[model samples]
Structures are given as C-alpha cells and as structure tokens.
Target: MKTNILSLTAIMVVSLQGFSSALETDAPETITSMGQIAEIAHATQEFFWQLVPPMDDPLYIHPDGIVRAVDWKKFKNKDFTSQMTAEMKTVSSSMYPVYRLTVIETRTGELLWHNSLDQLVWQTPAPLDYNPYFFAFEHWNVDSTEALDTQNLLWGRSSNVGAEILLLPEAFMESYEEDVALEAEAAALAAPMAMMLLSPPTVTNLMLAIGVESNEVEVGVYFPSGYTNPVDVFVCSSLMDWDWSLFTNVSSVGISEFTWIDETATNSSSHFWVAA
Candidate 1:
C-alpha cells in the first residue's frame, strides 16, 4: 500500500527516441548508485522509490510499466543481507507465489494483456520490524534487456507493500460509442438494481494513506500502535477496457511474444502466472 515504498497511479505516457534506451542517468539511487545489482540466471533487480519511464519523471521516461518499490530514501543504507533467517528466506521464496494477470475484456472478448510467465529470486524481504514503514533494499527487476522494448512491461515488489507492474497503457481504450439510444437503453434498466446493491458491510477500522509528490502517488499501509503481526492484506488492480495491444510475457519463456491464433473470436485468451 506504500508508494514503491505501494503506488500505481504513477503510470503515464512518454516519447521514446529509441525502443531500447532508458533515461537512467538519474534512476533513483536505490536503482543506480545506492542499490546493488545482482546477476541472476533469469532476473535482474531494480530498487527505487520511483522510476520515471513509468513515473512522470522529468529525468525523462514514462517507459511503459512502472509499478512500486520500497522508498529508497529510507532503505538506501539498509543492509538487506542481514535481515534474513532461513525460515523467512524459505517463506519469501518458495511459499510466496507471484501472480500475473490475464486481462481479457469481459464484454468485448478482447485480450488486453497478460504476462505468460514470471519468476522471482527473493533478494531481501522488507525490514518491517525496524524500518517500521516496510522499507527494504532492492526488490526484483527483470534482467532482460527486452524489458526496455515498447512491446514489454516490467513488474516489481513495493517496499513491503506488494507486487506492482509498470507499462505505458495501450489502445483498446477507445471504446466509447456515440449512440445515445444505446446509452439511454442501458441506463433505463439499471437504476432500480443499483439501489438495492448499496447496502453497507461491516469491518474493523483499517487505515490507508496516499501521497502524491512530483506526479508520483504512493499508497502505504498503517497499523494501529501496539499491534503486532498485523493480519495479511491483499489488493489487485488494473487498467481494464483499455490497451489490448500490450504484450506482457516478462520471463522470455516459451513464446517470446503473444500471437492470437483464433480468427473467429473478436479477442483472445492468454495464460499468465508468477513464481514467488
């Protein structure tokens, strides 16, 4: 829920002179100077408070898929290696599962996007106890250079917040029809049903906060004082009804890109998964 430190609204569109270049001359230190880059067989990691290619960064990028990461300002100096015990490492790696999204327009039958496969090599878990704000060192970044491609999207873990993805939203969004009769017909039949569904549900008081600075919006989780081992929280969101032209096969597995084979259907159905 924190800004990379769990924000998703940072997504924006930008001009790319080259499909393979990044304006990282000033990537958040946690990603460049302050963060350590580890070479894994499959994944390369990026640690940052905010990334421009996806964030509305003046440093020059709105890359495509910018999700969240820990706030580097707090964890820039943290020793991630020292925070792990065998049990935590096992839970973080084997127990946690990375879940990618399969976005198909429920009504139009169009496949907006999907990450066919995903993998994570747990580098460091959030220092929830001490950082207090769920700050941690570098999370995960795809090592593949193809990530820079306008055709692909990137995903990362926010500071103890949750998994996030970054990408420039694509075209399918222009679905507005000017048929006034159609709109009137739909609206006429929905007023009564909507009123009945407005009943309130019960729940405990849970606090949430969102801060927007330099065009970056960050959402964070807060627990009541004295609360220990807070209950698990889950959230999932996406840009629906827009951009079906974006391909999200992040792991470079099986097929490098998405190709729709069925010509009869107006859209497609894709397979996506994540390895936590």
Candidate 2:
C-alpha cells in the first residue's frame, strides 16, 4: 500500500508540470485591450524620437553660433493626480467594448493621465480628432512666428532636446491662406491661426508593430499644453494638409507689427487668445 501511495504522488507531480506547460503555451495569443492602447502610445513616442534631432545635436545658433535642443527628461518621475486620471477615465468610459485608453508620461513611464476615446467630450459633435485626445496638455505660442517658421521647431524637450521639426512648407501656406480668407470674410473678426506643426503617423506604425488590427482609424495633433499656456504639441495627423508657406513668410517678415488674433478653441470648449 505504501509503495502504491509513493507512485501516485510522483504521477501527480508530473501531471501538474504538464498542466503548467500547457497553460504557458496556450496563453491567449490575443492582445489585451489595454495592451493595444499602450502599444499605440509607445509607437507615437518612438516616432517623436525619430523626427527630432539626436539628443546631442544643436537645435539653434545665435550670431555667435550658440546651439540648443529640448531636454524632455526633466519632467520624469512625476505622479498623476486623481483629477487627471478621472478626466482620462471619462474619455475611456465613452468608448465601451471597442477601445480603451490610458495616459502616462514618457519620462518615467508613470501613468500621469488617461481616458478612453469614448469618454471624450466633443463640443463640435464631429468625428473625434485622435491627436487632441491623446495629448491634451500640449500648447504653443501662436504668435511665435519666428519659432514656428525659421526655427522649424515643433515639439521641444524641457532639457533642450529638439524633436519633430515641421518641414512641410506647403501646409503652412494653406493654413495662412485659410486664416486670411476667413478674416477677410469676417470683416475685422479675429480668428486663431490655423497652422500647427505635428508629428507623423506613429500611432498607425505602432499598431502595425504590435501585430494587431488597429481600430484607430484617424490621427490628429495632440497639444499637451492647453491653449492657455503654450508648450510644444505633437503632430500626428493632418500634417500633410497644413500650409508650410505661412511659417516661411512669418520667419522672413518678423513679428514687429504682429497683432493678436482670435483665441484657439480648447478641447473643453474654452478659448485662448493668439497673436500674429
């Protein structure tokens, strides 16, 4: 009887090992919903890295040839607030079953903000622009014509590491023409400048990288800095549609006579003034 019991115990151990192996091998090939969102965000970040200058490269030079770049690492390791998380959660709540999103910082990999595509509050009630949804905090100077034009600076790191310069000259022109036409039609009405620099379609690339069918059909610019305070915003979609000539003209002419235009429309339906 004792011998039989020993044999039974050995068989049980082997059976458990086999079960564990099976579980490991069959571990669902499907990506989790959260994983998909994270993957897209990661892809966007990588794209930003490719567009900007190398960390050691100089972004600008003075008459004496001084160089600079934005160092984004400075904003690392910060904690997320409950309110920010709630805002992101609201966005996620809207897009049930289909997709969910989470917001996190690039520096320390901390989830500072997040929301689902469904929870986003669309004031205009049009199809959602993915760029603004992902990067809600980004902002930039509307009247910094020189920065927008000659500087070719798009998103900058706090430490001066420059990335994603706007090179599309045509997009700038189209934006300028549109703004000018709108102003003319309005007859002294103020309108915010439509021109914005953005990163390429990294989100799509990211979806491809992860080997999943990305539901994220469209992309847009994400300004981490809100309209009130200007910071470098990321460009992902509508980049090809922008008019680059607007920047060129501004860079050539300077902002001495520049006047304040209308404020930019916020994701929350607020407005921030812009100068030209």
Candidate 3:
C-alpha cells in the first residue's frame, strides 16, 4: 500500500515525537532540608532581669560587707530569628543559670541591699514594676540630677555618641575597706545569670556620680509580642523618654555591639588588641 503508507507515516512521526517530548519539560526542583519549622519569625520575648548587670563571671559586691574573691571566664539575639537546624533559642532560653542578689537605691523602690541568700536568691524573672520617676524623669524638670545624668548616658555612649553624660567616669569609691579590685568586683556579683553573661564591662563601675560618671549597666525587658506593651526597656541608660511611668516602660531594643564569633589560627590569622 506504498510500503504500508510509509509505515503509517513512520508510526505517526514517532508518536508525535513522544507527544512533543512529554509536553516540553526540564523537571528540576527536588532539593530540600525542611527539617525545622514552626516559623513565626520576629522573636525575643521574656527576659527582664532587673537593673541588669553581669556580662559574665561576677559575684562581686561591696558597698562594704567584704568578701574579696574571683576566678572565672566568659559570653546574641534580637527580634531574633534562629534557623538552628533542629535546635533553637529565638528566645525562650535557659542553658541553666540562676543566683541573684540586689542592693537597691538607684533612686528609690529602695531595698538598698540583700544577702543571707538575698531574701532567697532575689528571684525576679518578672514582677518589679519600678518607676521612682522611671529614669531620666522626662520633665517635671527631670530631677534626680537630670535623672542620674540621664542614666549616665549609657557609659557615655560606650565609645560615645551623646546628648549628655559628657564623658562618663567619676564614681569609683575605693574605700570599700580598701579595694582589691573592688573586692574582685564584689566577688564578681554573686555569679549566675549564666556566669554574669561572660564578663565584659570595664569602663570602671563608676556611679553615684559627682562628675557624671556611671557604668554597671545590665538592663533587659524585650517582649515584642504576646499582646505587646513593654517599651524598649531601659530607664537608667537613657531611652524611654516621654512621661509614661512604671519604671522606664521597658520592653526591648538591642544591637549593643562587639562581634568576633570565634578565633584560633595566628600564622598570619592575626590578633593584637594593641601590643606595643
């Protein structure tokens, strides 16, 4: 039939070239490691450590009670995201650490001191409610010496960027029975809070200013969610302006500074802090 109509038109041109190569496709996209999920992004809730201090290994205290001692070592987060494999801490932390002590009177709500297990280890993950004019007193003419020089303008802006603290450093009263590095920094502030947050505040714990000097900051409150209302937590380190009360409002606001991550190699890997 003319060679069977050219073999039935070569089998209908190889079945329409296998149906137009199966409707033209590339077929790529199968990579996945969707291991961790439950993402609601923007984190950093619960963490209120009153008058926060202890960047690490400190139990030191001595407005004069005496107990000079020392020996310890060191330590991120934000409206925090944590894509940690199958692990995390976007905020809901506890690697384990608790041990507290308070010596109030930063300007009333006065407890003025504690010890003998500080009324059972101070315990205040919540419930403080402060406000003795909640810092920097936002005008009634902001007294308390401009509300402690506006909370010593946070270590004079910690490297500086001011509105007024004018070079923070003037209250290191040495005679706490003759200082031994302030009795090894008040026996390193009673140690806990995960080992005083790995120690790193030394502009000199000055305060009670006579020359506008103050340092010994460690404030926290960051809530960002959970039906909102905490207010960027910081009263005596200036921030929460505008006359709202209840101890410097407090919720959160971060990004202090300092970043290295980790290090080791020095075969031109290099490190020198400043060694003459």
Best by lDDT: 1
- TM-score list, all predictions: 0.17, 0.20, 0.17
Worst lDDT 10-window in candidate 1? 167-176
Best by TM-score: 2
Residue lDDT tens for model 3, 40-71:
00010001121122122112121111121111
lDDT-best of 1 and 2: 1
* Alpha carbon RMSD to native, model 2: 27.6
Off by over 4 Å in 3: 1-101, 105-108, 120-131, 138-276
> Residue 222 in candidate 1 has what lDDT?
37
- Of candidates 2 and 1, the better by TM-score: 2
Model 1 sits at a Cα RMSD from the real structure of: 24.0
The candidates, ranked best first by lDDT, are 1, 2, 3
Clashes of 2: 47
Of the two candidates 2 and 3, the one with more favorable lDDT, higher being better, is 2
Estimate every model's Cα lDDT from 0 to 1: 0.24, 0.23, 0.21
lDDT, candidate 1, residue 194?
Answer: 19
